[model samples]
Target: MTTAPIRLGTRRSALAMAQSSQVARALERVSGRSVELVQIVSEGDASRASLSQLGGTGVFATRLRDALRADECDLLVHSLKDLPTADAPGLLLAATPERADARDVVLTRDGTALADLAPGATVGTGSPRRIAQVRGENPGVEVRDLRGNVDSRMRRVRDGELDAIVLAAAGLSRLGAEIDLVAEPRDLAAWPAAAGQGSLAVETRADADAELLETLRALDDPRTRFAVIVERAILAGVEAGCHAPVGVHAVIDDDELRVRAAVYGAQPGDEVVVDRAEPLAQEYIRPQGSGKGADAASRVAHERASGIGALVAGLLLDRGAAELISPSTAS
Candidate 1:
């Protein structure tokens, strides 16, 4: 008997298709099953309103998740950064593949860096975090609201309509887009990226079949998963949405996990930043569910990582992150 192809749900954007295609190929290799892409229109993709106006978080993932819940697809792929910190009913994040570059890049018509851009130069981006970071770096430049796919946004800069635009380097790499503009990658230390940036999330129904679960779990990279979990935990701890002026980046180096987070107030000068690191437990470093002790180890590791995240968030809140990121103050 021939097996049915796995239906992978995804958005219709070029980047989404590219990343989803990549995941499809990987799943086919691991499961020895054919995979097909099922494009789904999300509200975020359909609407022209600013992300903030549409509500900062979950705009992109909601519809695809709905399709999954409705049995329209067997799995869904999402840009993890766009996914809300909150869990959806009946869905589980089955996998987090290896991460890509989690830094923001400045695309300019000329070779001008963001800091070197002439005062009053216009930089386009719709992200509150980018807006605040751009302003903090060079308050003289005029930051303009920008929305659209990567191609359209880059076109504005190429056509001289905007001096530059901030975009995720991971998106560019995934799309493999070719352009005639200069790209400058920002330092993560100075400009932390959104939580879970540069990662791809493979989601599926919580009660998926054992074989399907195992296949999806094969794609999980523990290091990437742990880091993103810690980063996102901080986002959740602070009660901020994905589109808020909050930047959190976590990385696992050797046996240590380090995270840097920032919450920017509406004003350029108003911000709360925190940097913290912790040693990773042995079980988290190893593949998940390798032995009888695996379950207990995974649980403990998860709690410890979450605890560290809460600790950092507490530090920020204690230092006025709550006031800095409050909706009334942040926007």
Candidate 2:
């Protein structure tokens, strides 16, 4: 009997292909199953305007999720940062691989960091998060939205459309597209990064085959998973996305969680704010043991992380670090 192959859904972009292939390879090892890639052209890929015009956050992930729901694929893979804050009722984030470099890398013609860029030099990026931070750092510099896959964006710089571009360091490393990156951007005060930016998310439907689901779960990295939740919670709290400038970085070291977050206006030159936090020593905080020890611990940890994130975001907003958000969060 021929075993059914595990179908993995992915976007057509080079980064998406690389990420999807990595997950397929991992799943094959875990379940001894043949895996196949299903490329779903996303709306974001088809749209020519800015991502903000392409529809808000998750534009890149919705198509894959829909395919997963229709049973077209055994599982769907996504860049964790591109996923929206809300979860699909019938789908679950079965796993998140260990995180990669969470920093936003600055690629320039010269071997110079952000600080070394010439005065009034133009920086390129499609992310509002990067735009705000770049503008905030050097008001004298010009910032513009530069979209397309990594190579496409790099092409613009080579064609003299831009002097440098801000890209995820993890992406360049994954695609081996690093010759353009003049330097790696760092400093929470200056450039934090999108929440969950360097992680990958594996989604499986609620009714997916049991053995397959468990096999996929094996790819989950608990440390990275929790770290992303913490980071994403901050993004959700501030309601940051394609149109909003929000940066979040969370790390797990020695079983302790540390998060640094930043929020800025439409242009960083306008205003900016940043903050950091660390979860309490206790694994999770629960009030009077609401349930079984373990269950309560998980609940407590999630709530604590959420609360910490909210506190940091609120503090930043109140300080005029991030601009006023719409009445609704999905803005």
Candidate 3:
């Protein structure tokens, strides 16, 4: 008897394909299941409008999810950052595989760091969080809106059209972009990754086949899931979208988990940073008769992380950070 190949849906972009290919290969290796890539072109990819104008949430993920719902695909792969916070009815975020480096790196023309760039140097980025952070670092640098694939952005810098550009380190790595002048953000005030940055979301329908769910669970990493859970929880607690001018990062250090968040208002001067670290002492549960023992740990860890995230978000909001991102509160 032959096993049917699992259909994995992904966006049409190169970076999307690269990431999906990796997951497909891994799934095949671990489960001995053949995998097929189903290319999906998202509205975000087809639209020329700015991401902010598109509501910045679900533009890239919605179509793929629709395909999942229609049973056009068995599984969907998405950049966890692009996956919105609201729970999609009849769908499950089945797994979050091991995360990659979540830092943002500055790519320069002459291999010079951001600090070394001449005053008024044009830096290209499309993210409000990145723009605010870059401007905060160097007030004189001229930050400009940028869009397109990794190659096009890099080409602009190479051709001297842009002095520098800041992009997610994981995307650069996945696309194999040869980055020479790289600068990592060392401070939350200056830089923090978006919630779920550098992570992959494996989503499946609520009624997905049992064997497929088991295969996906095998790829899920508890620590990565916990970190993204806390980060996303902070976004949800703040009632902010994934594309909001907010940066969040979570890390697991041995028995301690630290969650850091930064909120940048509509203006450059309006910003706040909050960080919280706590002991990872969530109660562990091992379900009887289930072959999976780690599932319980994953759920407990996410719960603890969510609580910590809510605490951190509340701290910032109390300090008036909410006004920065809220349209009603904006001056």
lDDT to native, each model: 0.89, 0.74, 0.82
Which candidate tops TM-score?
Answer: 1
TM-score of each predicted structure versus truth? 0.96, 0.87, 0.92
Q: Which has the greatest lDDT?
A: 1
- Residue-wise lDDT of candidate 2 within 223-258, one digit each (tens)? 776777777877777666534566778776674667
lDDT of 2: 0.74
Q: What's the alpha carbon RMSD for model 1?
A: 1.7
True-structure RMSD, every candidate: 1.7, 4.0, 2.8
Candidate closer to the true structure by TM-score (higher is better), 1 or 2: 1
Off by over 4 Å in 3: 180-190, 282-297, 328-331
- Which parts of model 1 have CA positions greater than 4 angstroms off? 289-295, 328-331
| lDDT tens digits by residue: candidate 1, 1-331 | 3378999999999999999999999999989999999999999899999887888688899899999999999999999999988889999998999999999999998788888889999999999889999999888899888999999999999889999999999999999999789999999988999999999999999998877888888898888888888888898888888888889998888888888999998788899999988887666767875445755776776777788888888888999988877673232
Q: Of the pair 1 and 3, which is ahead by TM-score?
A: 1
- Local error of candidate 1 at 182, Å? 0.7
